[model samples]
Target: MIGPETPRRTVLRSALAATGTAALGVALAACGDKDSLSEQANSGSDKGYIAGDGVVTQLPPSKRGHPVEAGGKLLNGKHFDLADWRGNILVLNLWYAACPPCRKEAKDVEAAYRAYKDKGVRFLGVNVRDGAAAAKSYMRTFDITYPVMLDTAGRVVSALHGVLPPEATPSTLLLDPKGRIAGRVVGEVDKTTLKGMIGDLRT
Candidate 1:
């Protein structure tokens, strides 16, 4: 006694039916209800995080507002100044240690960083939550080498609010060489999609 599977249901089921940690991460991303990080934190549900539905938004040069500016102390106790990397393409990722999508995409992000780090591209991670210990542990676990700005005081968040809202736990913003936001992915960024975005910025 089983029910028929609708086509939409079949697709969703297939996506969720994959095996391993990646599949679990995709399932979690598809289940997020609340969009705001602050709202999720105060909901008392103790869910720790909410995943995004994987939305990518791009801004044309005319529509991309002023150059974004944000700087703060990194986990390594070194002061990071975004102004220092002004003439290079930059990727800014917002994440917290406990966010599943963040963990899911860590490898891809790191791989991308390694691939583009030497080609006039820079990647900066902004840990919106978690203190030094947890944030450092997450980076170690993921073998991440990119410098991450520890956003304990939310200065990074406030500065980049124009492009990246507090909606997605693992959002990524791609900035042009001049530091204006060119594109953003509001979820676990697929490696190919991220690469494409970066490639587009270079043109």
Candidate 2:
């Protein structure tokens, strides 16, 4: 009997099974076909998780939700407090070492971080499902210097559930200078799009 405590991947499989083939097709169609994530979702393989399509959603200031308050321990065991980055635009990326989309976008994400590091734009990775060693290795592989919060138990996910649930690995959230969610990229992010999103928040 799969319950609430069951792993998300198992839950996904169970849900898909219960939905039947026709419903699965409809669900895949709703996710769109342009992005790699959607393609992977339709591949009928357990290796690929159902990440969001490459849709970028921006919320205007009036419609923006409450400020995000979340924190966790980094892989290096340093404490991270989102409140400390209140005055800066923060990019929170949810990812893990095994996810292909996460691996694909790592370099671009790192590049964006480096490009905006001096402009009051901070990038933090919320490693959702990887162990410390694997997450550290992923960072090393991509030369990602940004701090990644080790969120093995999904604490950060629960904290930001009101704004953006960490349902999809490789999701990116762009928070405005005031610590409120300004935008979201629901799949592997492109460098140009990420830079533009940060630029908009910076200005």
Shift of residue 192 alpha carbon in model 2, Å: 0.7
Candidate 2 collision pairs: none
The worst-scoring run of ten residues by lDDT in candidate 1 lies at: 9-18
lDDT of 2 by residue, 42-142 (tens): 44333333355445666567555456666656788887777888899999898888887788788999999998898888988988788888988988899
Q: Per-residue lDDT for 67-96 in model 1, tens only?
A: 665555677788776678889999988888
RMSD of each: 11.4, 11.8
Number of backbone clashes in candidate 2: 0
List ranges where model 2 is wrong by over 4 Å: 1-48, 159-166
**123 in model 1: Cα distance from truth in Å?**
0.6
RMSD of 1: 11.4
